[model samples]
Target chain A: MHILLVEDDLQLGSAIQRALERLAYTVTWLRDGQSAIAGLADGSADLVLLDLGLPRRDGLEVLREARRQKVATPVIVMTARDSVEARVSGLDAGADDYLVKPFHLDELAARIRSVTRRHHGVAANRLEVGTISMDLATAEVSYRGERLELTRREFALLQALMERAGHIVRREALENSIYGLDTVVGRGALEVLMHSLRRKLGADAVQTVRGFGYMMPREPA
Target chain B: MHILLVEDDLQLGSAIQRALERLAYTVTWLRDGQSAIAGLADGSADLVLLDLGLPRRDGLEVLREARRQKVATPVIVMTARDSVEARVSGLDAGADDYLVKPFHLDELAARIRSVTRRHHGVAANRLEVGTISMDLATAEVSYRGERLELTRREFALLQALMERAGHIVRREALENSIYGLDTVVGRGALEVLMHSLRRKLGADAVQTVRGFGYMMPREPA
Candidate 1:
């Protein structure tokens, strides 16, 4: 996912940019509110981490103007304003979520999860297919009673399939999700990864639909 | 939704362009494959309608190049070649759907709906909350077995709410969905439209969450 981070604090901004990059998210960090407004209106941001305090303009004003102009990108306000009135005003001004500063990276990740899940029109952080559960908050997967250990590529593959849950997910879509657009991946790399994944679970965990894609049954057979 | 149209036939291209615009879809119409490739790579189109017979480049070549470059936009191939092999090849080259020539406008609309639904990581075209059912193919809504009367804005609003059924869809998000990002809408227009929709569906159909937005129950109250 691509994130637009708006913060002028060098220390906190660098920390967040680094953390998000570590999580494999593409981050574009801007140090002022004017750029933040333009970024939000440009229609590329999957989500925005906005700060209420900024150098050029107020963050609330940026958000308000964006919303008034019908920019619908999900925004999580990360700021030091912890008052109840401030949070209420933030939400009223079209922030999708409000996060007080001095927070842990884990909490930030979890909030990103919840906000994005809702942004995708799913109500909760959990995506379930049969006995396999994907916890978006922790980025964890468990099958039956055991935690399913997966590599980053495997996790991306699983996420792509499980997001659709019970359908034949297109192979091209899976490749784009796992390897990302513009990433050079070798031929048969996906098959090799799928082999390892199926071996980790069972052969029936994901079924290949010949010439089409792959499907995971809503119920494991 | 924004559509990228690639077709060389002036008659068919003009008809489709007009029809899509009438349906409220923004279309960037291209007369050949080279521009289609560039348009697909630009990432603005939500969907692409590609004609297999093109001027400068073969449609399959365009599709193949775009897919090779990892452009993941959903595309429906419109072609006069109706052979099973041609259809299979189109799908293999990453076309999301195939439409043979002499297709009705209704059929084209249905294909667009299905392709877009799957592109959004959803397997089905039906969104049901409570007794209200929204049919993507027909763009129709039925509440309690009775057809609901909705204007375009009202339909857009209902579709937005029903897409995120059972959750409090933010007011700003709803406004963006009902009115396009570049549209100029008056303040309280959403409220006025929502009131009329509720009047038609029933007062209890949608409930407001104060200081937040609106929620429609999974089961009607």
Candidate 2:
């Protein structure tokens, strides 16, 4: 998942950025609302973490403008204003979800997953294909009743495929989720990850859509 | 499909824009290389139709900058420069396809489809699922041996679904392809289109993947 984080506080922004990165999310941290708006307009990020109290332009205004422009990238409002009125206003302004300041990183991550899942119309964090099951919250994959170990990138790759199992997930989309947009990734990085993931899961667990991308078979053979 | 058209000539730009819109493509037209570069950086376009001769910055420079920034959006260069060397240089600069100006609009449209198909790793313009086949080049869909007529948006929606049969295509992705990113589409437009398509094809032709999107079964059920 790629997150465009609009937080002006240097310490908080850096900390959130690091935490999301650790959680395998590609984070693009911008300090103000203008840049966030521009980023959203250009479709640079898959999701947004907007802090309402922003410099140059208020984050709520940014969200409003994004919606006005019909930019459908989901936005999650993060602010110190914890009142129900504030939350309702943010939601009304087109924010998909809200996060109050002084929040735990774990809670923030959960909200991020929840909002993205809801946006994708997925009802839960657990994605399953046949005997293979994955818990998005814990980043755990289990095959038939046995737990399988996966590296961070491998888990991310699997999640991307499993999220839309039986569909060809584009190579670019997978790379964006695993390595971010600005990173110069090697051409074979995904292939390597897929090879490892397949070995651990099952030989027929993943299918290459040749030239397009990869897919997790809807019904494992 | 969304195309970022980078051309400086006002008459030519408008003509191409109108033609593409007529062909059901959502086009974002820019008149300079700098704006084109910014647009590409923000992932605003699905593909680029670029002119070599540009203002402020050379079109080649824009192409180079986009590649340097790790922007992998496919670009098709459209220019009056027809020399072998110029084509070679443009291809080296990461252009996916090339077209010389004073060309027929039909040929341009064909090349657009060809290039986008090649980029997606689709070897041909025809997509097939069981007895149903769609000729993207001619916009003709046939069920078994019977020909079926469809509206433009319906054709586009069916094409998107059939392109990756058996995979769940996200509703957002489908909407982006049908209505473009900036258009305010009605909520049930997709559902209505899918309903019409299913009626023509078969009740089991398309599967609703709940909130995520829709899919075409890998095998006819």
The runs of at least 3 residues in candidate 2 whose Cα sits more than 4 Å from the true structure, single-residue gaps closed, are: A42-46, A83-85, B1-53, B56-221
Candidate 1, which segments miss by more than 4 Å at Cα?
A: A1-14, A21-47, A53-62, A65-73, A80-86, A113-127, A135-138, A168-196, A208-214, B1-221
Model 1 interface RMSD over true interface Cα atoms: 15.9
For candidate 2, what is the total of clashing residue pairs? 2
Model 1, position A49, has a per-residue lDDT of: 95
Question: What does fnat come to for each candidate?
Answer: 0.00, 0.00
Q: Compared with the true structure, what per-residue lDDT tens digits does model 2 show for residues B1-111? A: 899999999988987787677567999999999899889998979899999999999999999899889897878898897675686577657676778777755457657
What is candidate 1's TM-score against the reference?
A: 0.44
Clashing pairs in 2: A166-B167, A167-B167
Residues A1-221, model 2: lDDT tens digits:
67888899999999999998777677878788756755565454779999999997898898987776566789989999889998999999999998998999999989988888888896768888899888878777899889998888888788778877866677877887777634656789889989998889877888775545776778986
Candidate 2 global lDDT: 0.80
Q: What TM-score, to 2 decimal places, does chain A of model 1 have?
A: 0.66
Best by TM-score: 2
Give one digit per residue, the lDDT tens place, for model 1 in B1-221.
99999999887788778766755689899999999989999999999999999988999999999988989787899899867567657765767677888675545766787667544534566878878887653345788898664566777788778866778877766765665443558868988998999998889889999888998887777
